[model samples]
Target: MEKNKISVTSDNIFPIIKKFLYSDQEVFLRELVSNATDAVLKLKTIVELGNFDDFIDDFKIKIIIDKKNKSIHIIDNGIGMTKEEIKKYINQIAFSGAEEFIKKYKTSNIIGHFGLGFYSSFIVSNQVQIFTKSYKKNASSIFWSCDGSTNFIIKEIEKKNRGTKIVLFLNEESKEFLEYNRILKLLQKYCKFMPITISLSSIEDKEKETIINNINPAWKINPLQLSDKNYLNFYHELYSHQLDDPLFWIHLNIDHPFNLTGILFFPKIEKRIDIQKERIHLYQNQVYITDNLEGIVADFLSLLRGVIDSPDIPLNVSRSHLQSDPSVKNISKYITRKVADKLDSMFRNHRKDFQNKWENIKIIVEYGMISTENFFVKAIKFFIFSTVNNVYFTLDEFKEKIKETQKNKEGKIVFLYSSDKEKQYSYIKEAKDRNYEILILNSPISVHLIQKLEFSYKEICFVRVDSDHIDKLINHKKEDKCYSELSETEKKNLKNIISSNLMENYKFSIKLENLSKKDYPFLIIVPEFLRRIKEMNSIGKEFFEKDKEKYYQLIVNTNHIFMKKILKETCEKKREKMIQEVLNLTLLSQNLLHGKNLTLFISEKLENLTKK
Candidate 1:
């Protein structure tokens, strides 16, 4: 037994550790539990090598809460500390800088990135007492005690245990640690994946010991050893409160450039962007690290659910350094690459299944492609475009299929899409009648992605099927025919009357086109470029705000009998009512009629029906 002062860089070390070294006071439990797990794992390795003679039959870490005494003890049956080992490892603060330590020992399997985790216990406790018995043959048991200062005492003690027990005397400010439920929650959050059996016991109920963690998680074992049922069961175990199951999972086993192992699950996401959250749990040798793995996993891919255990990820460092680290960037890139590869494989191998799951997985894929250029490049061949009829096609395949029919006059393929199937159903039908394929691009992000896709492809353009005249939607015509001037003049007057009946919020381009008499007389066409710019501005994207106003074309069919009858009506009041009704119907079909305008339209129609 010896009495001495702890070797540290400064006398103010205790204050720094208590206030600043760790942001969360609760992390002290994590640090202590992690150290216990490491000690157990180290003993296991030594036993495998036949170095330790006094072999323990069982190994586990136990947490005992004594509410009356205001003390919490973390007990572990592992390799205990000798006097010399304690003085060397515990007395001295690991102050030799991160770079020096990392250069000396590149392995992270030995404790945390910083070997100062033991001292973290000092952050929450007024005093800490350690009772230890070395596994070495004929070794004496020892007691080490320290208050929240540089002073510590080591002495020989009588003990029946073959391990170490750390008893923390909770400080006045940190008395919450003495609560059984508080300790239980922390254990479940950060220590749940530890590679040792962890249990909790209370002096109140001595017989029942509750085991809290699965020491051997499915991610830590050889993935080949697991079946699909096993994987799903583990997911349910990890996320029991979440009702929906994961769509699919990728068992990542990489040993080449860096050692990494984990399972990444594509979760069943709500068809909304706001509900996406980072559920990717990170671990180091089965010890929980951080859930906010922003730089380690791509921001968009962080929405996936599962576990990632990497001994090579330098997650124990400072936040700024972690964000800028080259290994972290590589890790981020590697994860996206692997995810892209997996998605590509699934898309190619089981297209039917992929399509079935596409609506659920589309958010991640589109978000990833928009957020990362590397993923977009790799995912080009795999980005599928599905039509309203449930038919799916890759970018190139869709283009080739439509090249002969949908090519424009300038030798460019014009891809027609609809934002709303029901509102744009008539336009879709018109395009379908002309043998033109229309894609369903209604996802909120699709507008941004389509704009980006157009930027990538100079020879292609995407126009909403309702954005232009049906004859011009495909640009199949190579010639133009002259029309009668008197008919054109009458169509101009009809356009003027229609425009006068509506609000001035919209910029209307009224034109007459040759069409079947059965076709509707009035059609609304929203231009693609203006509509996209306006949509971008709505989301605070950099675009012309003033140009964000709504604009559409009111196409009148002079060849249709209904249009000719409206133009040829003699009674001015009935003629004006007919024009207003026709224009309101067009606006309703475009989903642009709302509020007071819709109410007034409904009222006018009711009044006319009553009079008739």
Candidate 2:
């Protein structure tokens, strides 16, 4: 037996490991189980290469909890290290710095890049012991024991099995690990479907038995051998509580460039922002590393629910390594492309089903497109827009159909919209009369999104239903004459009467137009540009929020009997009060008449009529 002291820069090393090495104490189970899985995989490879002749193939991991002794043992049948090998790999910390370690072992098949994984045991265990005999011929068994401190002891021991057994003396504060059910749950979370079988102590009827895991997960098996039913069975096993099945799935199996195998599922995305971390699980050699994979995968891919197992990921600096690695970027892009391709294929093969799922999937696709430009370019081809009238069309299809009809006088395509059908019913009716199609962009993000599209596409415009007069929406040159023209004095008097009767908060300007008698005597035209600007201000656009320059036009039919009567009444010195009454009526019709001015107008008209 050989002994060597652990090389540390300071006596503070153990303190650092105890207090600051890992974020959560529960993560200790993950690290220990992950190390065990790696060991089992290595031994399997060795056996496959004929390095271990006549070796027992019953290589199953086992977790046993002894509540009475306040201990738990995680045992694995793997390539157990010899005493000398343990001296090098276990006793001495190999890598002092992350960058140096990554560089040194860039080509190595080593699973744990950082030596701190073993130290994670100290989180839950006051004392730990390892008993093992290497698979090498005539190799002597060894027992290594350590307290939470740096001090440790190693000696030769007699053991029959060629594997390792890690016995953790659970700390008083962490006796939860010694519970039969608790350790079983932890094992399920960290090593449920590892390459080698994992077993937890269980009871069959009245007799004690071992509950073994399903070693060959769906991703590890041959896809050709699995039927559609097989893949669906695995999906149900993964998400038992989810009521609805996934829209589609991508079986990710890549060996070259980087060994990564997993299934990415496209669950029904009802809400765009509901896409969050923890959906993607990161694993190293079938040992779960983390589910909070912000830096590892692109933000948009967080909407994808699945597992990703690859030993190539750097464990020393998980976040920084993921952010800087070119291979990770490539892999992320590939996954995104695969997801997009699957969606497009689904749409092509099954139109009815695709349409049903489109509403639920639109949010995710739109979010991805808006965030990543590469995804945007790809997703736009498959994106379908549904109209307020329950008609669905792609962006290209809609543009082709409406390019001529919706084109404004300025030669820009006007995409008319309405936020509230009831509030803007009058405007919508007038637009429909002029044969204009209206879209319902009621989503909170629609305002900003439409603006983005306007900038992205040339000669495209969007306007709210109540934004402008019906005739001005899609202006066409017409040669017909309008309502009877009014003199300058008549127009001025009409403007003054209405303006004086309206509220201070509301501005009204009168415009004379020749129209048929059936037309409204007064049409309230909320100016297009100012209305949009005000809407933007209300939604917290700092630039236009406080700008006081607002324009609204009170367009009155000059030939209408009510307007003619008001003008004649205004010309009379004693009848000016009656004209004010008529002007108040017009303001009330526009929902603008209120407060002191309206009350005074009513009083003055009553007093004039009484005197007459």
- Top candidate when judged by lDDT against the true structure: 1
For model 2, residues 1-612, the per-residue Cα lDDT tens digits are: 999997665356777877787777877877676667667766766676677786575877877777667777788888787998778777775442222323643433335556567778888898999998888899999999998777889999999988899988888899777666777777777767766777776322225445645677787778788877777777776655666677767888878887778888777776446645337778776666778766566676787777787766655432112435677777777777777888888877886788888766766777677677778787777777666676777777878878888878789988888876766777788777777778776653566557667878878888777765666667654763454667778877766765565545455555666665666677766666666655555553454434322355767677677766776663554455554555567666555566886787778778979994
TM-score per prediction, in order, is 0.91, 0.80
Q: Name the TM-score of candidate 2.
A: 0.80
lDDT of each: 0.78, 0.70
**Candidate 1 ranges beyond 4 A from true positions:** 1-8, 95-108, 275-278, 317-323, 478-492, 503-518, 540-550, 558-571, 607-612
- Superposing all C-alpha atoms, what RMSD in Å does each candidate have to the true structure? 4.6, 6.6
Counting only residues 3 or more apart in sequence or on different chains, how many pairs clash (N, Cα, C under 3 Å) in candidate 2? 3
In TM-score terms, which candidate is top?
A: 1
In model 1, the clashing pairs are none
